[model samples]
Target: MKKIRIFIIDDHKLFVEGISSLLSDDPRFEIVGHALSGNELLSKFTELDLDIFLIDINMPEISGVELTRQIKKLNPKANILALTMYDDYSYVEKMIKSGAAGYVLKSANLSELSKAIEIVASGKKYFGEEIQEMVYNKISGKAAFDDKRPSMNELSLTKREIEILSLIVQEYTTQQIAEKLFISERTVETHRKNIFSKTKVKSAIGLSKFAFQHGIIDFK
Candidate 1:
């Protein structure tokens, strides 16, 4: 099998280093090159032939969205996958509309991220779970909701953790949520702690506020 050639465009040295380290040992992908900004990528774009691009939304001199547009203009068949920390629907929509084949959160596990690259390389769209939920909620406000629980719109939290966070926002006591979900309070407490750790919050109120600010959950 031919390895997918991937070029990364991001200004954060840690992000570039981390991704490179993660993929270097993988057999399915070949890291052809990397650039700290879209401008840098543009300068090196024509010099190397690559199949996929791992792009970040924010950069020093040009954004991944604009870069994706320019890339498509230059090579209409190029596959681009957005990798970022922002799970804001606006960012995802912007990247998608700008020509990214996939929009994945930086929080996604290695397997999920790799699968997105593979799908995009195969000429298919890969919208992360949070992205899909955001689209659904935007198009239909609370239409398919159950019991008025807000939809969790970011993969930064695992599915189970998101469920716990949603319940937390709904003011459900950890015990109540555990009982409702048919799990032990101990399990719920563990998930609650994990949610707090992942979200960097010390309390439920702070978590709710943080989620609201990031568009991870809506109050309506």
Candidate 2:
């Protein structure tokens, strides 16, 4: 069987090395590449035809949530599994909204990470038990996804912003977005910043969650 082609994006060198070592020994996975930030991952997008991406939630420059958005834009079919230490609902909600198939806490055993990778690679959702609890709590209305979710039209975003936000939810990077829309990288960044401000979101995950909760994209 062909090994699953996987890439990773995280800032912690020690963590990346440890995770890489763990994944290297697995016959089912192939480490295609790794990067320390969203910018680096975007720079190497063309070099990797990844079957899945293991993205950290927190990183310098751009967070994993934003990275997921950018990745989805480049390859809508890309399977993203957030690798993070956060088990809070905010993290779970944001990642899911950013088009991640699941969220895996860094504290999880190696077996758990493998399971998460396998599940996401197969196009299924796999939230760690601790994270699942938050998902459940949100669905049960014990906690809210966001305070004020705005509908796409009500958000007052330009048509281009809507188009870009849709792709961001799909994990498209700024470069991919530029190529897709025939715009410059700076233009894409400008639009993204505007989207963030208009949506009152601090990260890609927050905007994605707001978009989903507000029915901005009819994702099938």
Candidate 3:
């Protein structure tokens, strides 16, 4: 199997070194290069052939979102994954919109971080559980949004379905939701299937986008 080549771009040297040391021993990954700023990365861009970019969203020079945009422009097939401390939905949304393949928090365990890298490298999206919860809370009005759009009634979602949807958006596993709601995991799965059908979304992120666009959840 070919090892995944990864580049780290973060202003924090300790963070960069920590990640490099963590992944350096893994036979599946190769740490190609790293940089302290977006401009630094761009300057050395042509020298590295990276399978994934682990980017910090809150950078001093260019934000990760903008760096993602520029990187995508430089190499449209670039697989970018955000590794950041920010849990704000605005940062998450911006990174996604800017063409990030995944978002993982700095607080994530090594296993989760490795899983995110592999998932994104395999052409899939990954959002850390905490990040998903952040998005869910923001969209569900746990964080205030000034938009007064009408409620999501056209879907005719039952109260139970809405409750389940919120939990799903919050990245709660079926087992976790079941345990929390005093229901069976199978029942939670059933609700999830129904929610998918009703919302016409195949993934949690898709459901999130639909929720934001359809006034089921608010952003801003």
Candidate 4:
């Protein structure tokens, strides 16, 4: 079988090692490289011809969202999946915007993780059921499930830009947003500025409120 080359970036060494071991045992996946920070991931990303990257949303230096943006810039086909413990509606919306093909919580079992990878690798979205529910509830407004918000692309934002926009709404510090998105602080700031320019908003709060009001984040 042709194995999928995978890279992982997370701050937790124990969790990284454990996940590496699990994927190593799976014939469908080949663990190529692992890093503990977004900076490390960027520095070493080119060394490994990765087919997919599993990034933790919160990191020390660069954020998963930022990193995914960089990776997408370099290789648009790179499949980035965010593996996080946060299933909050904001996080989910932002991760999708950032260029991640899917979001799977760290609390998920290995089986679910594997399924997420396979599903995303196939060019389809994979959200945990709970996460899906959260998104649906937020978008449908009354949890009626009938009137759903449009797809993330409907905003005309690129994958990475979408991710950054979502993070902006979450009130993440620039440093924290950088680490979670895997970009530098300067880049995050630049993106923030660009978001303001594009959305014609003056402040982060404006963007957040606008996103909520326009059903950009659902809660419709």
lDDT per model, in order?
0.76, 0.79, 0.79, 0.74
Off by over 4 Å in 4: 142-220
lDDT, candidate 2, at 143: 68
Clashing pairs in 1: none
| Better model by lDDT: candidate 2 vs candidate 3 | 3
- Total clashing pairs for each candidate: 0, 12, 0, 19
How far residue 21's Cα lies from its native spot in candidate 1, in Å, is 1.1
- Taking all chains together, each candidate's TM-score versus the true structure is 0.64, 0.62, 0.63, 0.62
| Residue 88, candidate 3: C-alpha displacement in angstroms | 0.5
Ranking by lDDT: 3, 2, 1, 4
After superposing candidate 3 on the true structure, give the runs of residues whose Cα lies further than 4 Å from its correct spot.
143-220
Superposition-based RMSD of candidate 4 using all C-alpha atoms, in angstroms: 15.5
* Higher-lDDT candidate of 2 and 4: 2
- What local lDDT does model 4 show for residue 108? 59
Instruction: Give the local distance difference test score of model 3.
Output: 0.79
In model 3, the worst 10-residue window by lDDT is 211-220
Residue-by-residue lDDT tens digits, candidate 4, 1-220 = 8888888897766456656766788899999889988888778766778678888887777777788888888888889888876667787777777788899766555677889998888778888766777788888874523334445567665667767776666556899998887889999888778778777877655665455334443110
Give the winner by TM-score: 3 or 4.
3
**lDDT tens per residue, model 3, 1-220:** 8999999998766446656866877899999999999999999899888799999887878989999999999998899999876667888899999999999876566778899999999889999877777777787878643333344476678778878876775567899999999999999989889899987877776665455344343111
- Highest TM-score model number: 1
